[model samples]
Target chain A: MSAPVIFDPMTLPSDDNVNAYTFCVELKGGEWFLQKGKMIAYYGRIEFNGIGHGRFERLLRTSFHSPLHASDWVVAQGSGKMLLADRAFDVNSYDLEDGNLTIRSGNLLAYQPTLALKQSIVPGFLTLIGTGKFVAASNGPVVFMEPPIRVDPQALVGWADCPSPCHHYDHGYMTGVLGGLRSLTGLGGTSGEEHQFEFVGAGTVLLQSTEMLMAEQATGAVPHEPGVPGGGAGVPGSGHAGQGAAPRLPGQLGDLQRRFGL
Target chain B: MLAVDMSGDSVKAKNGSMVAYDGQMAFKKMSGGGEGLRGMVTRRLTGEQMTVMEVRGQGTCYFADRASEINLVSLHGDKLYVEASNLLCTDAGLRTGTTFTGLRGGATGNGLFTTTVEGMGQAAIMSDGPAVILRVTPQYPLSVDPGAYIAHQGNLQQHFQAGVTFRTLIGEGGGEAFQIRFEGDGLVYVQPSERNTIGGDV
Candidate 1:
């Protein structure tokens, strides 16, 4: 067998991937926001501080806007090259130039402090705006597709510059009584692809090669105020009105009861 | 997966790890890792147990365990310190023993002792993903997350570094509050993925 390549601090790649599952970020008196417990190893002198540290109050005000996610993020400072990875998943870095991208919170590994990170209005997702590089991990290699596409929810990693991202259910398949019965009970074979996240307008949609999602990170609880989606009050006059009642079973018609005007 | 080619010789491997063989081979269970009574008692006492099997044959044998990625480490007299679970296979000529690792092993949740491999031979280790081999020099020491550390070789001194402070008590601790600092001349193997170590959360 050929000798395995040994990496020294000088040979380690800067702001690039050492392998498919690992990314090396070089910090030279700069800072990077990293998710908790994602760092594997590092070289040189580097210090990791929790986001709530007093010294980062000013930095947090400008680059971090998600108060709920404060506990999940930390800041790495000093001069060194650090490796980032998550559960052996395929990790890749994306460069954003004055652009905005919304991604699942758990998929994000680390990002340059130049980009502002805020909790997405979509609940479990987070949004990054401005310019800089961010690293994300997916179950498989990410595939980029154009908008006007409907993607499996589990397969979707995120979307960039997309104007509208709405849920799309096969209206024709779930209209009548028979259709509703099939979807509600999985009787007569449900296609399992009845619902998808539809993206329109112009932008790039990122999808993993597989449909398995990474474990979701807790984004903390949003305020229980009105006019806020997932704000604990539930959607007003929507199918979620009964969500507070003991949780619904998978094949139950809990939400579909609203469709029947019951 | 690791394929070992032998010509009427023998190689010691993790027990029950052999998946396939292309030629004739005889497998024998090595009680106490074939290290005799003293090694067995030491391993049992240290909690660094290794159930090894010796495979002797004139053909090629394949070994695998739990679908983990296998990495090859060549030893030319220096000692290799690895977790018991990460060791896959080693040449029959090498001597395997147990050593006390102190706080570093406890922090990584691998007990307070580790397995050591010595002699001139090639050994195969396993990791959750491909392991990155890093060379540590005296000038530039390396600090690795305890959960990601798999193994190390050469003359290196490791210290369990904890950055816990008043902030850590308030739940605002740096996620990487605990690390294993390796200094000296050696090669450290770190997996791309981290195991759930006892000190992972802080």
Candidate 2:
């Protein structure tokens, strides 16, 4: 009968951390269903060099609250908007438009072959050639929203929601050495901050912190105003404690039946 | 050679690793540097195949040939953080740590990381910067740059999509395009703004 006076995850039974900032909520009503909607993303500005370089802190999500069931969502801000259907929820929108939504989740981003799910048009899978070949994936059907979602490097898969399949570029340790050399002589060298993968689509966007990252994060590994810190060559800045085999958090992909609660 | 013109990001660090905007997935050396007197090179390269040799220290440095990619021994310090976005590959890793999942609201771990500062220190140790985090919720839908992302919970459904005309236009550009979009509710970790400063991000 009335729009929620205050939409927030805090109002629900939260089993999360405020500093760690992970919260969860379940729906009160509604049975199983499939949700769909056009995705329009407007990614906010990014912050760089231990500074608030990211534009619009005011854009910080005030209420990370969502409905448990598939509901209709629309892009309410930025350059445009789109209508996603009654299946899932919109996590957080961006400044750019994912443009449109086409496919449902089903092993969309794995090294495994696309499992030909009905009439197929894959929009959630991305393949890129890094030191190790990998794919970007989602948990299930991606929804639409106004502002883009802020993501952690650990959960990001890529940004290539294009028509043609994604290609991987190989650059073994040899190239890293060569690139490392060039930066010294000023021949060529980016701050290593200008790198990004492309994933073009308006499908369900899956993401979460890798288990490996969590291991270190809980200790406040971020560079803060600490006592004079050391500098690791490729690693940079120092305030960490441990050596030998850092943990790794592998990425993943999934499908629909299990995602939308159908 | 389809280079996606890239720019602007006031968000987080998980996306520090970026490719050339002109459209190309080739990994090229961008630059190099070092810690103590030994060998190290820095160059600009493209693609995800490139490996960024990160070093954390406060000591005398040296110059060497481009042959040696990284100085494994020189990464010593209090807490050396490098943005993983540009990192092509690591020697090895393990999914040994905490977790946060489910979709409720504008999640994305509230647009932050899941592990506590003190907790992540156990892992972010020897690494630079904080963990770039992401959260997915029922209401707040989020998409992230793959390269910048570190690790995500293992309950999402990863899929691909086509680009451009898939929406406003039709039947153009050879068949259809593809993209990586996720659904469900979970947290995606990432650096706030800083990235893996390979070559000379320090």
Candidate 3:
């Protein structure tokens, strides 16, 4: 057996990836906003402080805008090279130039302080604004595709630039009595790909090769505003989309008449 | 998967790790990791027990463990300290023994005793992902999260460091409050994924 390559601070790349599953970020008396518990190792002098620390009040006010996710984030400061990885997933760093990118909250690993982090209006997503570098992890290699395409919800990783994203249900399979019956009860052969997320306008959509998703991070509850998607919804046990409320039998055909406005 | 061609020389591997083999091969379970009676007693008392088997043959033997990534470490007389569970196979000429590791072992949830292999031979360790080998120097000390640490070699001094303050009690402590600081010169092996450690929540 032979020893693997041993990397030192001098040999480690600056603000780049060490491999497909690990990324190295070099800090020269600067700071990076990191997700809690994502740091694997580091060399030199570096201090990790929670976002609620008193000294970071000003920094938090400027860049850290999502108060609900405060507990899951921290600020890494000082001079050192740190290694970040998540669940052995493929990690990559992207540079944003005075632009915004929306990503799944769990996929994001760390970002520069120059970028402002905010919760996206769409649930379970985060938007980073300004010009800086941010690291993200995916179950597999991420593929960049132009908009004007529909992507499976589980395969979508994120999107860069402005694009209108909305739900696109296959009207042919979702309308009519037979379509509704097929969806409500798996009779008459219901293809699982009847629904997708449609993206239009100009932007880049990121997709992972595998449909397996990383464990979803708690994005925190949105404000109880009237127009919010998940805000007006009550407790999870009360049931919003017919899940957890009751166990329907195989041939029950759940809410088919209501869906058809019969 | 690790494939080793053996021409009469034997190798000690984890029991039940042989996946497939071709040609001539003899598999025998070595009692007490082939370390005699004293090693058995020490391993039983220290709770660092590992069941190893000796494979000697004239053909090719394949070894695998749960489809994990295998890392090869070459040792030229320096001692390799690793968790018993992470050790897969080693040259039969190497000496395997149990040693006390104090607080660092407790932090990793691997007990207070660790397995040490020494000699001029090669050993294979298993990890969830490919291990990253980081070189530690006297000038640049390395601090690692306990959950991600796997093994280390060469002259190194490790200290189990903890940062606990009033903020920690209020759940506002830094997420990386518990870490293992390694100084001196050595090579540290870290997996890209973290195991659930005792100090993981802190």
Candidate 4:
């Protein structure tokens, strides 16, 4: 049976533009409570990103520190099935050391092109944050100024001409001491093979928070990889906790990529 | 970063032609005989005032600064247009325009100005998406985000109205209301969502 729609169109903001995209939720085992009334919303000028593919599930909540004027209205909400385009969501993400905000989403298409920054482009302060199970198709060409902003390994937009930061994700253990420290501090440090993606352009970065890889390890849900269709909820997540998280390097990346059809 | 300022100027766009403003104006003649109307609407001018007229076939536009004072027009071309009846100098922006800027405070009623796109380059209006000009027959359906509306298709027009007695508010009136009711058919262009907060978290 079709799930009954509950939204009152007449009740929507009078000035709002809406089409008859009516339908509450249509699923069997799909819990409506987990999905209904949940929508991503914002009151700012956000350009569009591209298409994306992956199992996505995140819960985010942000409240303003003070009563902001109307010029910048406060916003909240989330997404479930994200239809992102190519180049819309970069494979990697960046860490905005300055004014980056945390977010969770079902799909996030940052208008910021997921490409390497140009040699001339200076790495500025604005950032693009996203929180979802993102598996980008492009590794990226992150470009920026001499000393570009430090980018997070997992949270990246794109890259530049020549990429660097190929070092160990940590200075200590392959899976123990370093991994422990990384988790303890949430510091995405580096090592020999670890590379921090860089952007060398006049672009903004989108950001979000996710433990999709870790969540999968704990919940046994595999995410749908790019080339691989369906099921972003069964694989053993990367960075599994101590004895439980997915294994370290040597074979982990390959195994995950294979299952994800990368 | 999108903020709707209620304050702005109601400079003149003589039906069609498009032109720019340089803090100065030159008002021409105005009989103000809007087809359905019975008489010529009279007007008065202030310190800074002028009139403009876009002759029928001359496809061009004119402009004026945010504080330029203006009034009704004589049918230079397609005269009656827009979602509301008023468009003018008002002050309703995020930051009141100081000496550097001028915002005629208050919201202009919704409606369409027949000026060329250039005439509207600096003009902001609410629409469904890329505005679709319609023939306004009784058959076609016309709908739009009250916020994206510029004008409707007929003499039957509606602009920004205050109060929830006519609408339901989630928190409070967005200050932007819903459905600028238009009985006949017309056109509207608007972004995918009037309340779209996509890339950044507002």
Candidate 5:
């Protein structure tokens, strides 16, 4: 048997991955905004405080605008090298130079405080803007694809450069009444690939090799206002009680339209 | 997979963990990890129970469990502390026993006792993924999430640290509220994945 490699603070890489599933971030009295519990271990004197801490009020106001997710995040400050990992998933770091990228909330691990995090207009997603490096985890290695491409919803990690991402259904599968019925009820053995998230214009799309998705912690609901996607109507306590919490599929055109063959 | 070669020497391994063997082998169930009657009673009381079998006279014996990654550690008299479930196999020269871990084990949801392997030999531990071994020194103390901690060795002082505050009661607690701080000189083994512990959600 061979001895395992032992990493010390001096030997640990700075702001890089220790292995496929582990990333090490070095802090020289600097600060990092990390999702709660993503920190597996750390060396040196690092302190973790929730976003609600009084000392972090200014920081949260400037970079962390998603109050709905305040409880799920923490700020790690002080000098030390910390390690981050997620459910044994592959973790990679991306540097955004004054660019914007929207990612599935559950995949994000840690980011430099120089970046501003906002709740994306797209529900269940968060957008990071400005310059800095951020670590994200994927079920498998991430694949970068250009725009004008369609991707399976579960396989998509995020998109960069503000690509126009919208739902697309295969015309060959949803062309007629029979096709609509087949898709709506799966009565004709509908293939699960009938719908996808289509990206057009410019920018790159990130997709995990596997379709397995990370379980997302609800980032709370969007504001109950008209003209907002996932707003009003079916939201709980909006007088639409009993409608259930199951989110509407992207390509879904409502039960009424599908039933009437619209 | 862990391959153990023996030329009449014996090794203790988790029961039923041997997957393949080449050459003559004798497997004897070591009641209470071969620690004798006292060790058996101690294991039963501590609840850190392990069913180990001694494999002797083997050419090359392979051991695996659930396809988990196996990490090999060579010891030279220093004791190795690990979770019972993570220990795959240990050389016959090593001695295994149970020790109270206080609140650290409670925070990890692994009971209040932990398994310790002492003496000079090689031991194999299992993890959900490959484990990262970090060194803790007097100048650089280490803090670890209880859920991801697997094992540690050398002279180290571990203290269960809780970050709970008034905000925690108000539902704004950091998700990493429970951690174990290790000071002194030692190597801490942390898995790439975390076990579901009680402090995970908060």
Candidate 6:
């Protein structure tokens, strides 16, 4: 067998992938915001500090808007090249030119401080807005598709520049009493593809080759206030009372009585 | 999967890792990793026990474990130090032994001893992903996270470095608190993913 290629400080790629699973980012007295515990190795002197570090108070004010995710991120400062990876997943870096993209919270590995990271309106997603480079990991290779497409929810990595992203249930699976009963009880054959996330408008939709999702990192709970999507407050009938009710499985037809026109 | 062709030779492999074989092969359980009594006693005392088997008279034998990525390392009179759990197979001529690793092993949660392969021939090690071989020189030392480290070869001195400070006590700590600093000339193998180490959270 031939000898494997060895990487050193000078030969390591700057801001590029060292391999399909690992990415190298060179820092010249600069700082990058990285998720905690994603760093594997480094060639030069780099210090990883928690986001709550008193010195980064000014930096967090300008670039970081998601206070809920503060505990999961860190600031890598100083010079040298550092490698980033995530559970051996396929890691890729994308450049954003004054654009906004929303991605699953757990898929994001690291990002430049130039981009402002905020909690997305959609629960369990984070939005990055600005011009910079960010690294993300997917279970398999990422496939980019145009808008006006409905995709399996499990295969979705994220979407960019899209205006509408809503749940799309198959018409046959949601209409009649038989359909509702089948969906609710799984009495008949359920293809497990009855629901998908539909995207419209002009943009790119990112999908992984596989449907397996990375473990979800807790992005922290949203505030309990009105006008919040998953704030768990202000909804009169669907408050904590819903938590006490029987757990509803995904694709379950809600309010069977109402569906029967009772 | 790794396939080794043998006409009338023998190879040491991890026990129960043979997935398939196409030719005549006699498999014998190597009591105490074929290291005899001294090595077995040392490994048992160090808590770095390894169960290996000797496969002899094989045409083509295949070995695999847990669908992990396998990497081959060629040694020419040098030594390769690896975790016992990551070692898959090695040539019959190579000498396998356990060595003290000091604090680096403890921090990685792999005990205070590591398995070492000496002499010539190729040894197969496993990693969570393709292992990145990093060349470490005296001029450019390398600091690696304890969780991602798998193996290393050549002449090297490793130092267990901790970045824990007062902030680490109050729930605010650099996620990468424990690292192994390597100096001298060697090749360090790091997996693309990290294992759960004792100091990983800090």
Most DockQ-accurate candidate: 1
The CAPRI class of candidate 2 is: incorrect
What pairs collide in candidate 3? none
Error of 5 at A130 (Å): 0.4
Candidate 1 per-residue lDDT over residues A68-131, each given as its tens digit: 9999999999999999989999999999999999999999999999999998988899999999
Comparing 5 and 6 by TM-score, which wins? 6
DockQ scores for all predicted structures: 0.89, 0.02, 0.81, 0.01, 0.76, 0.87
Worst 10 contiguous positions by lDDT, candidate 3 chain A: A243-252
TM-score of 2: 0.20
**Which candidate would rank higher by TM-score, 2 or 4?**
4
Q: Lowest summed lDDT over 10 consecutive residues: which window, candidate 1 chain A?
A: A242-251
Model 4 lDDT tens row, B56-171: 22222233333222221122222233321223311111111101001111222211222112111223332332222223224323333333334322233333223233212233
Q: What TM-score does prediction 1 earn?
A: 0.96
Per-candidate TM-score, chain A = 0.92, 0.20, 0.90, 0.22, 0.90, 0.94
Q: How does residue A192 of candidate 1 score in lDDT? A: 87
Tell me the spans in candidate 4 whose CA falls farther than 4 Å from its real position: A1-71, A74-128, A131-262, B1-38, B42-80, B83-148, B154-179, B189-202
Candidate 1 displacement at residue B117 in angstroms: 0.5
True contacts kept of 5: 0.80
Candidate 3 local lDDT, residue A91? 94
Tens-digit lDDT track for model 5 on B69-97? Answer: 99999999999999999999999999999
Each candidate's fnat, listed in order, reads 0.83, 0.01, 0.73, 0.00, 0.80, 0.82
**CAPRI-style grade of the A/B interface in model 6:** high
User: Where in model 5 is the C-alpha error above 4 Å?
Assistant: A234-262
TM-score of each: 0.96, 0.20, 0.94, 0.28, 0.93, 0.96
Model 6 misplaced stretches (Cα beyond 4 Å): A235-254
Winner of 1 and 6 under DockQ? 1
Which ranges of candidate 3 are over 4 A from the true structure?
A1-3, A233-255, A259-262
DockQ measured for candidate 2: 0.02
lDDT of 3: 0.90
